[model samples]
Target: MATKMVGFVWAFLIIIGIIYALLSGNISAINDSILTNANKALELFLNILPIIVLWTGILKIAEGSGLLDKFSSLLKPGLSKLFPSVPKDNKALGYISSNIVANMLGLGSAATPAGLKAMQELQTINHKKDEASAAMITFLVLNTAGVTIIPTTILALRIAYNSSSPSIIIIPAILATASSSIAGLTLDYYIRKRNK
Candidate 1:
């Protein structure tokens, strides 16, 4: 459904752009951009590929060393409060912890796999697989409002663009994400209580 919506949006944008270009007599520019967009996308992918590989490798190492498990254990107490529906010794908790940690470090691309795995684990215990469970909603809220300590992608982009203070937004990012997370969790709790 989301894929279909996105496709519609892209199609709309392209049609609108072409119409505007026709009206403005910039058809050549539009054609040029259409031809070059793929190359630009490839270039961007090549630039970000090394960072993705490096971070994925580091996450793999952490997994091999049992570091992720150790961290998950440490988070169990607090995370249990947030995810009471999940089993005490569930595999879902580990993936959730890993996802949170990766997001906190601002490794968005690296967090994707763990987040997906977490959802998969979450679904196993869901009575209605077609609908989201309470724990799943809570996890989605938390992940969507993730607290980023590093803002790594933003910093990397800034550095690539030759910013004088590439890392200056770190503090602001942390504060904003923390605030968002707290607000999101509060609302989730309120909704859950109302439902009960």
Candidate 2:
């Protein structure tokens, strides 16, 4: 897997190099762009750290206060119906619910650990020897196409770039993410049905 990933990266770099060579007749443009972009990337990353930390810290407080569990319970009935394979009492369901809630609020830092735990719990429940179970696949799809609200990371980037209306992206981000989530789940359902 590591080798395959490395190979893919090399292939991607080769493609980019070809494009750069064809356009500029030299690699100097690419070198300069890489140096400039690396600095910008680092600055952007630093700018977002405070936002991520604040949100994740809030999530920890919510979890400790048991508010997350209460919210999870409120959401559980519908989620249970959607993910029939996951038992109501299962830890995976709790983790998944927390992860989803965090993602919906655009708290990626907060969602990471919960999502990892959910995946671990899901892997534990897999009865099959060779492949992922339907529930696991569905969860992966849901996580990948998460329903975002604030889009905090993008907002942070916008702010770093000195955008005036960073928060104005909220509505569009919510709509776009919600639509992607619906599409992902719908596709997962069809695939699961076809496989079954």
Best candidate, lDDT: 1
Q: Which candidate is the best by TM-score?
A: 1
Clashing pairs in 2: none
RMSD of 1: 2.5
**Overall lDDT per candidate, in order of appearance:** 0.84, 0.82
**Runs with alpha carbons beyond 4 Å of true place in candidate 2:** 1-7, 22-24
lDDT of 2 by residue, 1-196 (tens): 8799999999999788869786888877777876798798788789998887777787788879988778867776777777888887888988888888888777676788999898888878789857888988888888889887767678888888899888997888778888988999998889878987
| TM-scores for all predictions | 0.83, 0.82
Error of 2 at 184 (Å): 1.7
**How does candidate 2 score on lDDT?**
0.82
- Over 26-90, each residue of candidate 1 has an lDDT whose tens digit, in order, gives 99999999999999888777665666567667777876898866865787679988998899889
